[model samples]
Target: MEYNLEVINLTKNYQDFHLQQINIKLPKGKIIGLIGENGSGKTTTIKSILNLMTYDKGNIKIFGKDSRNLTKQEREKIGVVLDDSFFSPILNVNDINKLMKDFYSNWNEKFYYETIKKFKIPDNKPLKEFSSGMKMKIKVLCAIAHEPKLLILDEPTNGLDPIFRYEIVELFNNFVSNGENSILMTTHITSDLEHLADEVIFINDGNIILDVLKDKIDSEYGIVELLENNFNNIKKEDYLKCLKYKNEWYILVNPKYEFQKKYPKLKVRKPNLEELMLLLVKGE
Candidate 1:
């Protein structure tokens, strides 16, 4: 199947940070979660793909067209929610709706009004008067109102309450159910992705460390908690990451079958996204 988005050899350089040869692909009809620590190049990668920043070396394609040379029509197929509100704070929800209708030819005024109502956004209140959570909801509302085929979300759920967050996640699930739409989101809430993501990409300090389907990760890797004495006994090559507390060891390993079979005395459990990320990001 053709990919909805593809990035090959994506590289960027800054005074103190570098986004090295990052490569990623998002297939149609899938929600891929991008996870990284603060300043790990998630925003940089998104900006590069959005043509907001120039990269030194790489090719980014969306809808099989070069990202850098997208036509107006091609650009319309994407919906973006960045870290901050891109519009003027003086604009109210109604004003935003009017502006977007003028900008995106496909904008659905009906849907926009309904969504704002559903999200409990006050039409007359200026964006500057809204709380952070309210601002985030407006951004999300604006992004989906045009019915784009692809969504590029950066910290999409920041400042959202749990109730709204859950609702948005459910909306995302429905968005891709038709098998034509796709989403690339970077969120700190790994728990949300643990439930909604089809695949997870882990990036660290500019390098792509792991990119795998959620199912494959669960089936292929397992976390083993080992006592100090048992840590040296397991085969080291099996370990993808290992961390030590006071005396216990948290080991993330591949070929889980072999490790589990060999060490019947230890318990092996599937690690959630957060646990896996912690091991990869914090462990040695």
Candidate 2:
């Protein structure tokens, strides 16, 4: 039951936005997918975890040590891939390799080069000249070159093609196969989470709204579409959330099997991650 990262009562406030007391736990050897709409505080939470920004109140623990007090050696055990952070675009593969060698004591140059060759990334091209997908691949490679135990990534698959995204997903699967490493990633692509994540945390308006196992999302949660009259017939206590679309209504119900038993013809079905988020965020 060891956790790789824990956020306890984390809170940050701004003039127009507030990240309320947030709590998250990333267990070792698991992939936790953080999901939310744009400007919903996904990036803010990540920045706070990385100590890139200060929070008003909370405790963040990484590897059981206060994140703020992590030693240089301890910091090296974590890899980070931020959507807007990277080495200067002018730097090429060799330059980055040279810089990383000085930055991390365990930099794996051989493995880095092998990965570069496997991905067909040019060794001499500047990052500025690479496409978004290429740049993303390089960033991921750089993050893992140091052989870290935990990876924190923001929007790692934002602009990749299906083929590349599949490859990256496979790479992530391989990363945790050893049962010692873990990854925390944020992406708008919930489908990827359906295939890769062990747990999913949904954040909205700077607050965590739902945290559950990926399997439970399918096995225990259900979605029902019906007309307003039929929707009103269902007891409020039986469903978690509901949304209205013109003449139709969608309800998110837990323990769908029971709901199905009650309304046998209601067409209750499991929700995909995206549908679940939509109902949670926009449903009343």
Candidate 3:
């Protein structure tokens, strides 16, 4: 019933871009997907929550404690995977496993080796000799084998094949099924989120465009296509974004009863996550 992580009024200013007043609540036993374009402050937000970067304003809490106040034991309960891995390239998989066993208080040696076997990762080969996908698999294995309460990942399945992506997502599903763990992942691949995320947070240009349950997306939001003649009749306030191309107006709107009553003849249809994302980011 409690949130695993809370980000409130988060803001950070830079010379060229700003992460402004972002907020999110990630409940335990749920996976929340974060989607945004490159340089849209997705990584910045994650880093801010991890306290890897200094923020100018707002509070970030994990497991009911301010992130900065977490003890070594508390910090160990968070398993993280960034866009890049931090393991030394010269270290082989066996070496990494040995290091991890010593680092985490409750490291599961059985689970770690099982994961390596499942992933088909070579224990004797150094990371530098592995492909990007292989290295990513190792990182994922390391994160999950520790049995953390929360997993924060960025682009965790970037280079994997479709089958493995599904497997990894299945792992996420299993991780949260017990209602004791949760995950917050930022991914450019909306399809992955569509399959795994219970809720989604869409950010654009450092601002939150959407943050809602995935099921509510279809029921509450839609795209409306209007003929050229009717385009001028629709009010701008009704739609979140609009575009005029090929003599038709494409608009995304909440489809409230009032808007539908006003234009019963308008064509409104449900959009999938990827389509909706595109309309919001590129429609205007």
**In model 2, which range of ten residues has the least summed lDDT?**
261-270
Off by over 4 Å in 2: 227-229
Residues 1-284, candidate 2: write the lDDT tens digits: 99889999999999999999888888888999999999999999999999999999999999988999999999999999999889999999999999999999999999999999999999888999999999999999988999999999999997788898899999999998888899999999999998899999999999999999999988999999999889889999889999998899999999999998888988988899999999999998
- lDDT tens digits by residue: candidate 1, 103-138: 999999999888888888889989999998899998
Instruction: Name the TM-score of candidate 2.
Output: 0.96
What residue pairs are clashing in model 1? Answer: none
Candidate 1 steric clashes: 0
TM values, all candidates:
0.96, 0.96, 0.91
* lDDT of each candidate versus the true structure: 0.91, 0.93, 0.88
Model 3 Cα displacement at 75 (Å)? 0.8
Candidate number that wins on lDDT, 1 or 2? 2
Q: Could you tell me which residue pairs clash in candidate 2? A: none
**Candidate 3 residues 36-141, lDDT tens each?**
8999899999999899999999999999899999998998899998887478899998898899988999988899888889889999989999988888888888
What's the true lDDT of residue 153 in model 1? 97
